[model samples]
Target: MAVTFYYAPYSTAESTKAILAELEHGLPNPLATRIELSISAGDTRKPAYLSDVNPNGRVPAIVHDGVPIWESAAITMYLGETFGVRAGNDPHQSSLYPEPGPRRGEAMKWIVWTNTTLTVAGARLAAALPVGTPGAVEKGSQDEVSKDETARKNEEEIARGDLAKNLKVLDEALKERNYLLGDQYCLADTHVWTFVSWLSVMGVSTEEYLHLTEWLARVGARPALKDQ
Candidate 1:
């Protein structure tokens, strides 16, 4: 049976959509069937979705052969393994995933780091600013402004600093390699690149990090992204 992909427009589900496109690029048959959910319209809050697919009522969940998986990173990893594109148990074996050993360990490390640390930092920063202007919120609201706006402004400043620090760390990590794990493009790149791309769309400039900027350009050019 084909996998069932639950997604919402303009959400993080775009990452999953990209991964699916990549898989279809390599496979002869379709990997999954997409089901659009309107979160703004409260589609996720429906009883069927809440109980049957994702109890958490979130987008980017998948159902494979009756098994449900949520979280973008986990979904990507699962797809990689199921497709036999993941790194093999033997370091010398050829696969999309790094072979087992320090290389594989490094891949896992970056995957977790991108999903947790980087994802959280980017989200916090994005949440503070207004919908259309990321990281560009005013430092302080007018004297008559409500406390909520003031709090948002304060949060924006803090989040901006945090985002800068996180980006720097990523910049340093990419200085010596073309991809996150050396030359080969692994699943970790999919997770990290998605978050980084989100920042780009949010008006975060990556020019200061030359290597990362180039990397984003390379990955963004993939046909899978174009399909989305």
Candidate 2:
């Protein structure tokens, strides 16, 4: 059965695009047909999309073999385990997810953490930006920013400090490893890197963290992510 991926430009769906490309490069066959939706036009709010695709009405959902799956973590894990192989297969070896054991547990842990903890930290930084900054309006500022200028500035300071603390955690984890799971690149790397790159666009810098910087470079060099 074929898969249908629902995506929207300049959104979280890009991570799914990258992972699909990565998997198809080494899998036995093609993955799915991508259907791009326009969030600005309320495509996700359409009745058919809400009833048939994602009940949550979010982009990045996929319909595979007539059953729909939503959430980045679920989609990544399914693609990885279903078609993933280690290096040196006839087609090539694509690993969308980690193998069993300690690495698998760590990958699962970090996948959710990156989706929640790391991403929320990044969102706070974006939400706290002052008016007139590029991309701030698209990201949506805090409600407090509209009512209290002083509160918005306070929020920006707190967001900055919190993000630094979270980055330190990631930086320390990458100090002795290449990818999130030590050396083998998998879905977790792609998932986390998506948001990290997003944060950089909002003015968060990773240059000062030596380990984190090197890790980002290594992941950024992947062939699958190039086109996406």
Candidate 3:
């Protein structure tokens, strides 16, 4: 049976889907499954949809054969292992996810950091913007901020504080190398890029993060990420 991924464009789930698209070998494009079914986050709260798989109603969940997988990290791990590209397995692709070593630990650190830091911070920032502003392009913005100007400003300040702290962390990390875990690109890079790339769309600036800005440009140049 084919693996099917339910995705919502521009959502945090895009990170895993983007990585799958960039796999060097063996990884199946879950999007291509002929029997694939999709339920965008826009409608995932429906009773019928959430009952069968993902009771929490999260997007980017995948159903492989008859088994359901929720959570982006779990999905990524499953895909990597299923394709024989898990760390310590494929030497050629090992650079992306190296064996049990400092590099691998570094990769995992950044991956978790991105999910908890960048993802959360970005969500806050997006949630802070005016409902009709450009930042409202993401999910939470519209609901959190309506036409009220004062409330929007308050949310914006709180969100900016959180986002700035994490962005600085990323900026400092980039000073040492092009990617998070060192010279090689790995899940860390892919995961963080998904949200950092959204800064410009939200009217945020990366001028202070020169290294991160440059690295993002390099990542943008990648052929595989072009599909994202």
Off by over 4 Å in 1: 84-94, 131-147
Full ranking by lDDT:
2, 1, 3
**Superposing all C-alpha atoms, what RMSD in Å does each candidate have to the true structure?**
5.3, 3.0, 3.5
Pairs in clash, predicted candidate 3: none
Alpha-carbon runs more than 4 Å astray in model 3 = 24-42, 84-95, 137-147
Question: Taking the tens digit of each residue's C-alpha lDDT, what string does model 3 give over 40-145?
Answer: 3345666855886678766767778778887776676566546424555455553444555777677667777776777676677677675556756444422353
Write one digit per residue (lDDT tens) for candidate 1, span 124-158. Answer: 66666674464322223111122387887897678
Which of 2 and 3 is ahead in lDDT? 2
How many clashing residue pairs, candidate 3? 0
What TM-score does structure 1 among the candidates reach?
0.85
Point to the candidate with the largest lDDT: 2
RMSD of 3: 3.5
lDDT of each: 0.74, 0.77, 0.67
TM-score of 2: 0.87
